[model samples]
Target: MNLDELRTIMRQCGVEDGVDLDGDILDLEWQELGYDSLAVLEITTAVQHAARTPLLEEEVALLTTPRLLLERLGTLTPAAV
Candidate 1:
């Protein structure tokens, strides 16, 4: 999905309301954003559903940032990009 959709998913998944995630956010680890394993699972599952793709749980677990997740999703489902 697009950046706005990614950000909205993050927010809905409990990211702080107005954290002002700048460009630097792309390099930050998912854990740094306060997402536990469960949160990641939920977010990735949501993304998979939204993108209409079948994302492996192991693949999602390997993603360390939103950019990485987006990139992976894009690779898995071109329509998502």
Candidate 2:
């Protein structure tokens, strides 16, 4: 559910290539990130394994970026501004 955990899951899912996890996942083009529907499914699967929670379909929509995904997974706590 954390950034590190999300990154690890994404690496396992083979969607991290040519993608930048430092910023946001949703900000990038899905095609550019090498994601098709299948890849997204794979990511969702890995995310479930990593987060130990079976995400709802709607949750996937919220998982647009690594940051967003991590936020959805409750992995990333908001830091003080």
Candidate 3:
């Protein structure tokens, strides 16, 4: 999904900062955005659900920023999921 939608998912996953999420935050690391590894995994799962796409585990492991995740998701079609 898009960044705004991602922001929503991040919130639901317990990233408790609207100010950070509202800013130009695409490039921020997950840690800097108030998420740990566990939370990141949760976020990835939520993203896949929201997008109706299956992300590769290796690719998910490589994700560092919201932009990167979005880019990865963009490469997949529903059929590819």
| Candidate no. 1 TM-score | 0.78
Residue-level lDDT of model 2, residues 16-37, one tens digit each, is 4566755555445445677777
Q: How many backbone clashes does every candidate have?
A: 0, 4, 0
lDDT for model 2: 0.65
lDDT (C-alpha, whole model) for all candidates: 0.75, 0.65, 0.83
Total clashes in model 2, counting residue pairs 3 or more apart in sequence or in different chains: 4
Give Cα distance to truth, residue 81, candidate 2, Å. 10
lDDT of 1: 0.75
Q: How should the candidates be ordered by TM-score, best one leading?
A: 3, 1, 2
- Ten-residue segment with the worst summed lDDT in candidate 3? 72-81
State the TM-score for model 3: 0.84
For candidate 2, list the clashing residue pairs, or say none.
1-75, 25-65, 26-64, 26-65
lDDT of 1 by residue, 1-81 (tens): 777787788778887554665445665787887788888888888888888978776777788888788788764343333
Best by TM-score: 3
- Stretches of candidate 3 off by over 4 Å are 16-19, 75-81
